[model samples]
Target chain A: MIKSKLPKAFLLCVFTLSIFIVPSLFAAGTQEDSSGNPYAGKELSILVSAGWMDSRYDETIARFEETYNVSVDLQTVPADQYGDILQTRLLTGECADVFWIQSNPFAIESVIVDYEDFCIDFSGSAWESVVPEARLLSCKVGDSLYGLQLWHNSPEYVMVYNKSMFTEMGLEIPTTYAELKDVSAALYAQGITPWFIPGADGWQHQLAFFQIGGIYEANHPGLYEGLNNNTATFKDNQTMLKVLSQMKELSDLGYLGEDWIGSNSTNMANMFGDRKIAMAMANSSYIQQIKDETGTTDEFGLFLLPLADNSFFPTNPAGPTMFGFKGTENEDLVRLFFDFVCETESLQEILDNSPAYTNIHVNDDAVQQHWLAEEKAFVDSITPDQMVTPVLQTGTKYTNDYWMDFGADMMSYFIGRIDANDVLGRMDANRAKSAKIAQDPAW
Target chain B: MNKRTVYPVWFVILPLVFYVVFFLMPSIMGIFYSFTDWNVRNRGDLSFVGFQNYIDIFTSEENYASGIYNTLKFTIVSNIVKLIPALFLAMLLQRGLRGKNVYRTILYLPAILPFLIIGLIFKSVLNYQDGILNVGLELVHLGFLKQKWLSDPEVVWKTIYMVDAWRGIGYVMTIFLAGLNAIPDSFYEASEIDGANFFHKFIHITLPMLSGTIMINLVFGITYGLKVFDIIYVLTNGGPGRTTEVLTTYVYKLYSSGQYGMAVALNTILFVITMAAGVLIVRGMSRKEVEL
Candidate 1:
């Protein structure tokens, strides 16, 4: 009886030990197999414009490469030539694994017309939820997601002025076009450039006209709808013509810098610091840059671009956004790269590295944002009515595609080569061309 | 006949095949596509649109006509500016001078440097405010003479011609030097014995001797100026408002905006112009050669 009891106890102990040891062995094996990164040894390439990524993505991209044991090939092209390069690459089926576009709500369709053919559908991606609903329109066509827009929420293309200088000059921020002209005249009389429009940049000077879209829409209700539906045209719009005329007046008066058409924004901050120019159109974040680069102690403030008696905020939600290429052989690696960048750690790295940006406009609460106090105050000061609609370029379909052309036309008008109405008419013709290409029924 | 002197027809086959595959095929395909409603929207499915693209090119309010006009203007002016100076420089350098090789090297340096680097340097130098050129003028009390070299439409084309000449004169001079070198010294010696001056010799002997080289340079320069992009693109980007816009820039804009058919149509028009110009130039030069 004693021997039988001993055997029973031994058997029970052995069975219990087996239950723990076997599961532990299987769990260790599974962990080892699953933890092996699938993206290891793969390479990912990204094509982007210079300022779009800059050094802001270096840390995040480095960490991504380290984590996955891979390499990232970043091809940066000049901003002016980026559109042409991107178009050629996409058409030739030689696009990189990742590509970027200056995306707006209508850009994915209007700019990259064949998004389905070129971009990978990230519809069900885990990172899809990380993008905010407003930005999703830029990232998606219908229900299919194709881009990830990690942009700043700073007030872009607003009037950034030296507050201290304005105070010293006994000048108040101009709220109407007439006051703007008065202030400009006063500044010009004093031999100081009132506004430093960098027309040589080709894209910067157009903000005066397009950033006042709220004023245009307020004057003509359903203007955006009409423009989109082809019931309206940019031609013969009295407000726009007035705005163009005002711009031409500013150019003619030489208040828009000495040879503004030849001036670029390279030394704009220095000009602000030296007090050579009182104000210029720039992002709210540029105030910090001016302080940092110029080491100026002067207080800077943001205001609405006063043109054509306009008092409206530039309600623009547009920025450079990235997409995975559909033709990439390493789709899994591309997906992993996207997922890696959207992670909270990577988001923090990106935000920290971005000196030009104040905050990443994402839905992630864990991601720490560095919103500047002045930028915050500027946003808070905007009235509800001021934020009427998106800027003209982003609001209308196919409008932003011809931004450079429109700027050129505006310059032509300024130089007395083309009339204001011809400038507006040219815009109408451009929109029609784009609409025809887009096959928009409205046109 | 020797086998080397009487080559087989297969000798031309390989090069012809490559030419067709690489050049002729793409050009033909491009011409075909120009007639279609090909765009970014119609990727993988292009539809024929007859002469609509051409019609748009001509009738559109985009001032493509101005672009064509600018192209012709640039071709003519750029060649004149470049060829004349290059000829003079070549003649000067061909004669005995101190450190002629060094001068040649110095002159050729701009041609060797990439257009992008030259553009970047000159853009800074030509800037309206704080640029070296304007500042230098001010230092010398010649500030009144300083004009907006790049911004004023009146001065902008002249500025472009200056920059183009700077980069291109050396290459043209080098070619001219080669032509000059090929001329026997005996012609100049005989002309010297005839009491011929520099102008007389240049007209009678140098001009006739270098006709082939001149024709070559003209063909090269005209094609380059017709397809002028990098210099203008880098300097003014067809601006102070489209006063500087040429056909290539317009084509680039069209292509960038995803209007493939229109872009191709514009290029086809350019191709036609280039070919016509080439044929006329070569035919006239050949006729001149026959008369000589």
Candidate 2:
């Protein structure tokens, strides 16, 4: 009887120990991955326009996935369709874990419309200091940070031209509208399309007018302020009229391109590689892209867009910015992702992978920059006063929201359907409409 | 036909409730919103402005009136382009033609594709500089025939029509094919016996018999044309200087830009136009039927 009791007791003790100790032992191993994170095995999704985040973020996200044991769904939308799609998703309360907006100082309030309800409050996050001071305005509303703008500070949307081609043709860089027309005529005579404007893109063609905001400001010192305050209008401004006339003249002469009105930037690099085109309104970083994509031996350089005789650097402090969705289920993961991207290693990795960009403009000094020599020379060439004013679309209130409409109007002007004054008058009307919508008392 | 099989008036109550809640209520609310200060900034709270939205549509510098005009033009032109050719194609495929099934499938394939896919394909084909259409024209020594298919304002509308017809003719033909199949052989044979040629048979027998099909096609075509967005959007996006700017494109732009009142007013105009056209056609067809 004693031996039988002993065997039963021994079996009972073994079963009892297995129940408690086995799970604890298993957890000890699993804890390495979970790290007490409830969000483990969950999915985090990001919605962004195509050019905003490409394969540059892929490796970083992969590393993040490995670290968190979580999956990341990166959705890249076409630039033209992204605004509508994002707004639709946002209004439907179906936005992804993280989403991006082409943000400027006023974009968060005007574009997002209700940033408080939508964007996560990352005011005190570890990544706050990494954002440069100039970008802070775009990332925050009343000092409560809502976005992370991880973008390059390259001269945005300036004329990128083939230096080799210009040298071969004995053409000097144009510094005025008259010189631009002459150069364009020269290039057109050589059977090379000059000043290639992808007007069909519905976005690119307007840069020649908007990127030289400093020129506008210089001509009329109080124009940006007046526009913001609803005290001024884009209508019949002589400088603008001159610029519009220049663009129309280019379009009329076919110097922009044979089919520039229906062209896109898809084959632009190849166009440069083949020396079929001379220059285009593109980011300074595009010079590297042209070399990388087409394996072109020809050197490229940047020049101020000479439309309206403007010499200002396109000092746009706006960029494609990422925001954590306030309604996201994986909030912790979103926070972690933001933190991960801002780290020194990740920043360096992003800069290294982005062949289109030269540097990541952040406050972190640890990350090495890869600024191109041409870009550096271009930067050095600019006077301190040249960078004083932001680009027109971002500097003025509610302007960027009507970007497509303005582009269309510009198209209308280009094709002679509407005159220059009509284009400017329409912009005034649109701004008034948005001002009314925003309930701005100034309107 | 059978009274006993018919559901009672009270039986519709459940579905009526759903229809009112899901469809009717929202539509009425939308119409109400059209007159108000509704916009993206103030979604919940709005004030009635009473025809101001409509006034803006008619008078705005953006030329909303042109959008309506374009919509109307498209409705008339697109139908004329599609229906006549589709009727002939249907008649051709309905009868003893070699490889009828293969031909039918080949024609029907485009109709099944989504507008997005069709738009992308057409956009690539219609690209001005290096598109296959121009490249092919050059290769075959017909280079001068290659026009700026999408860019030139004079050609953009024609290009849109061409693309619209390509995708739509197949579907329209299919409907006509069904109508043709429904027509008994005895009528054609009887007409043949009476020394009627193909045109005579078609006019006297086929057309009168297929009046219902024609009416159905007309209504479908008109509505599709009025609400056309995707094709124009993908190809030109109301470009070549708003030459292709239709009502729906204007509405989309306004709506997306937080001008909901304007968007809805534009929509209301579309709604009225569609309904008015629908009523006129239906009434006309009914009178025709009575006359016949």
Candidate 3:
């Protein structure tokens, strides 16, 4: 009886241990999702920005899952932390099957230096036709297409203001830098913040100064080309200093907001909703976001930033691009997913779901464009002359690489740690460092 | 015929292998990489840039030097705040305090809470505009004392130190309590016979006996303070014009910006500082033990 009992006890112990150990051993292999689909045998993961991919993609993803007999694992990280996370995963050789990049012509070579190593060469894929020629440059490295960037040609990073609020506060749509200062004072007098720049947002605040690349380049011709060649410097530019000081003047005067340094973009929509601030710099899509998320009844409109007496529009072609991981075991499935997203039905569904977006920057004939009425009105208000200049970050060489440092420099300037010229000098130094590291011919 | 004996020093072979593989090798490699230009652009093309990265760290006119100063400031201040208060609390709890276990548990709870949760909660509580801390101060008719907690460069470090002490004091106090409990009742009895007063016994017996524990806490606290990241990140992210920027934050920034070589160099410096401090602490404690 004792021998029999011992055998049974040992068996029970072995059985219990297996239950705990086996699941963990297989944990990494079993990636699941809440996505509804009949085919759930294989798994696919996509990395995308927070606001870029609309809800219409859900139906498309579900359809792809059903047709391809795979489960799509959508891992959407917030924009602020996206770069760090994506870089870590890519470098560690554990990248998602289908990853993303806010790629431009230079980005593929500069940012993803090992595109051929990690990216699946999608050179002759049928989906290549749907991407616009200008945007096609963003997705290709050498002669091979390695990414697909299908984004809108809408006005981006433009100054969006509450028109009703401006009228109520007796403020004008500032046409020049001087007029902007006067208008800010007028709004501040009425207990309204003139502009809401979320400086604490690691990425957004610097857009005010950097987005006007046209004026900077136009004012000093060959500046962009010179910076790329390492011959030009951002240091001690009187125009940039003027812009920084203007920003500082506004910040110091409490026209940007009472605690602009501590504020984040998370409360921006709410600020617009609550009428706490008169205006902010945002993409055209964001006006829709402000209305939908905050349910604000305030009428909002867009205007060119009154910087440098310049009325240039930012024609940024760069948007989030999808690339396949060459290291992925399921390369076929990844290719299929990209192809599937390019289909007419899927593209239409994506557009329908994207209420914020007016249109997708694609050449697909079947996909119906859905530009918002407000965006159309805003575009109509602008002249053709104002709609041509490319925004600064994407337009210049090695500029985006120094964004965080520039933001920090701006903060330093605001708090009086560094002068306006010093801030510009730091930007030049950062650009030089990046240029050196990149070994760009311009440097 | 000679009698031969063999001992199993092989008993430590597995653990030693683990220590070398996980700790020693990576540490050595980190230092090695720090000297090379090993960034994202040069992933497959590493070149030796001996002392260049370090030179930039030391000589660059940027805010890197201020980070070193801030890091040192935090380490010293945090240790003093945690160690002194912890020692006193440990003594109090050892003195037949009511609900001693409950107090100990309460004190230790914050130590176990994750830094992410603690940071988020404290950030909200410390907000100047609508935070509970300011509201409470206002209710008490002390609105004058209410100030921008995280936003103000002058008060941000103090706020971090206070939050850190609040979370860490309990853990340190627990260690001291263990040291206190280990002491024999006979020591106190003999002291009483000699008519030693409270301070007399405390100075001669308690403190001397707690030296080992104190040394251990100091080492742990110093290393932790040196590598502090989450609290500063979640509260202010080394902001308000880099007032609270530390070595770790700089390293993090470099890593995030894909400056892997510079990032590794900063961490390598931290590692050296930590190891040096650790050796000094252990040697000092051992010498004191021999003297005692």
Give, for candidate 3 chain A, the lowest lDDT window spanning 10 residues: A31-40
Model 2: DockQ score = 0.50
lDDT of 2 by residue, B1-292 (tens): 7557766799899999999999899888789899999988898899999999998888889999999999999889999999999999999999999999898888888998998999999889878788899999999999999998998988999999999999999899999999999999999998899899988998999999888888889999998998999999888878877889999988887777777887888888898898899899889888988987
**Which residue runs of candidate 1 sit more than 4 Å off their true CA positions?**
A1-37, B1-4
Q: What is the lDDT of residue B144 in candidate 2?
A: 90
TM-score of predicted model 1? 0.92
**Of 1 and 2, which scores higher on DockQ?**
1
Off by over 4 Å in 2: A1-37, B1-3
The alpha-carbon deviation from the true structure for residue A108 of candidate 3, after best TM-score superposition, in angstroms, is 1.5
List the global CA lDDT of all models. 0.89, 0.89, 0.83
Ordered list by TM-score, greatest first: 2, 1, 3
- Across residues A1-443, which tens digit of lDDT does each residue of candidate 3 receive? 99989989999999999898888566534533333532347788887766657464898988887776678888887565577678778888898998887777778776677788889999899999998999988899778999988677778889989988887767788989899889888888878788888776667788888778778877888887777777777787777877888888888888888777777777788888988788899888778888988998888888888777767777778877889998998888888888888988888888777756768888877777867777888888878766566777777776776666778778878888888887777777777667667787666
Query: Compared with the true structure, what per-residue lDDT tens digits does model 1 show for residues B16-59?
Result: 99999999999999999999998877767999989999998888
Q: What is the lDDT of candidate 2?
A: 0.89
For residue B230, model 2's alpha carbon misses the true position, in angstroms, by 1.9
- Predicted structure 2, TM vs. truth: 0.93
With candidate 3 superimposed using the best TM-score fit, by how many Å does residue A102's alpha carbon deviate from the native?
A: 2.5
